[model samples]
Target chain A: MCSTCGCGGEDASTRVTLVDGPQPHEHPHPHDHTHDHATRTVLLEQDILAKNDLLAAANRHRLAERGITAINLMSSPGSGKTTLLERTVTDLGDRRETLVIEGDQETWLDAERIRSTGRKVVQINTGAGCHLDAEMFGRGLTELAPPDGSLVFVENVGNLVCPALFDLGESARVVIISVTEGADKPAKYPYMFRTADLVLLNKVDLLPYVDFDVDLCLDLIRRLRPDVEMLAVSATRGDGLDAWQSWLADH
Target chain B: MHELAITESIVDAIVEKVGDGPVAAVRLEIGRLSGVVTDSIRFCFGLVAAGTGLDGARLDIDEPSGRAYCRDCRREFALDDPIMLCDCGSADLDILAGQELRIVSVEVR
Candidate 1:
């Protein structure tokens, strides 16, 4: 036994025998016991937008490598987004290479119109989707063959609500609101106005005919987004096109 | 809506964490001010998770209380009301809470 046990014996003295318990049983082979373990509750603390932000960062890196300036244009239906793009492409026709990525629920009419302007254009049909997401814009960029050192204008699907939540790796996001849509638009849809880098008050030529108030609209927009740059223009008549073009050129 | 895309991502995350284990339920903490519609998320979860490992998994949403801080009055209050205002009758406020959209935990076997 060991000196501590006071048995004066070898290793056998160190072992103690059970008094009344059953004999221990031996397993046939060693194996993992995790199969019968209780299910665990894993706490995953993560930001919901973390994955989307990662993809957006990757898109930004790729766009930067090509030296392409992408702008995401958003507005409600009949806000003259397509018309503004038409004017923009024409105004910047020779100064800088321009490409149009038209997003619509259905129809290639916008793309066709842009094509007639002698510019490379691609149309992405979102089907029933309300907005164009980053993945859609990424695929469109690949197919449109966005020229190196060129400006790419992505006209998002006509909607004020859903489009504000998407980040398409655009250098700038421009929100268009027609004068006929009323002056309370900025107040009613503050999210779009808040996220916009520039707000284009289109169809200004129709201000005299319609009941829209340009001053009130501008005031509301200013109240909501104080730092957001704004342009008052009519895409059809090309009124104030020089200012819009100058802003683009500066960027 | 875009909730389908969010659901797909959530399912992917679950699969990554739990592997091929049977997922019994997924619990999400969605706030009222998260900008995500809870009904749309629930509706899309079933559609996106079909045939995947998370198929038939129950979705449990926990809506936490929201709060806002008044800039003018310098007070904090609950955002349970439709209008975000302070007890001092100041409407100018900045949201302090209730913008959470997260998968806090998952029960898997």
Candidate 2:
């Protein structure tokens, strides 16, 4: 049995794979090399996410050099992330070149939705992965390759927890929550709210029909992130979309 | 869930440095506020480390408690999770520690 977590047992094997399926990131080579006979401790004092962070930094540099603006959109499963992207991409139109990178566990549905809006889109299926990390984002960036001074929207997988942990080197992060997701979400998922540069309270048109307290939700989000800018919008009805567009313009 | 991906990174990093040989052990420092579960990583290590130098290697983990400093009250306190609030009833706080996810060392044999 493992001492720390007691996870070791007969059923201990677990598979790790990339978006391409069973291919691991690195394969163990059969190269002959000398092994040290004596045991020696090598001090590495390196952050566990160092590789991801480095790739994210490189991605940031690449985007900056091309004068591109990237926004990472995160939310739960039914937060209207794809609907919002479709509207935003179509509305922006000729004003600014907009592209999208769609991430999901399985399916190109979101990518097809964006493509239908006449925007260049890249679909990344993470298979069993819950979030899109920097490595995957880097691959998407390479495929999309938005033009200079364009806006790139990365629609993250619909999960509030793990998406917040991985930085995709976006210019800003926007967390979208609809009226149906409850007001206490900011408190329940503080990390997601805390890391957001902006929060969008989507589906405002349904607020009158639902029991979502807008003021209380804003208050809770403010408690977690005092400096983050918050907005309300209904992607379907075009309500409060002018402000959302203006915010996008400013960025 | 994400621990499998994390464990893969850990194993790949150590193997890159030490080569595909019999490693003795690896040490990691995991903090409570890092959002990475130690138990999940432990469950994933052996499986992720299987065809590499880290196969059958002992895993040593050091857990650090969450610590935060309240900007409003100028006082330090312990935090159990990511809900950042000071004892002075202030939400404005700076986290000092407990977000670490670091590889401390590796013992090669």
Best by DockQ: 2
Which residue pairs overlap in candidate 1's backbone?
A1-A8, A1-A9
lDDT (tens digit, per residue) of candidate 1 on A1-251: 22133343223222222223322222245665534423445566444554564557677888899899998999999999887888788878688889989999999999999999999999999996888878888889889998789999999999887787678888999999998897888877776776789999999898889999788888777755656899999999989899988888777
Q: Against the true structure, what is each candidate's TM-score? A: 0.79, 0.87
Candidate 1 wrong stretches, greater than 4 Å: A1-39, B64-96
lDDT of 2 by residue, A1-251 (tens): 22235354323212111213222212356649764335567766666776787788889999999999999999999999999999998889899999999999999999999999999999999998999999999999999989999999999999998888888888999999999998999988888999999899999999889999999999989888878899999999999888999999999
Measured by lDDT, the strongest candidate is 2
Query: What's the DockQ for every one of the candidates?
Result: 0.39, 0.59
> Which residue pairs does candidate 2 place in steric collision?
none
Against the true structure, whose TM-score is highest? 2
- Scored against the true structure, residue B40 in model 2 reaches a CA lDDT of 92
Q: Following a full C-alpha superposition, what root-mean-square deviation does model 2 have from the true structure?
A: 10.0
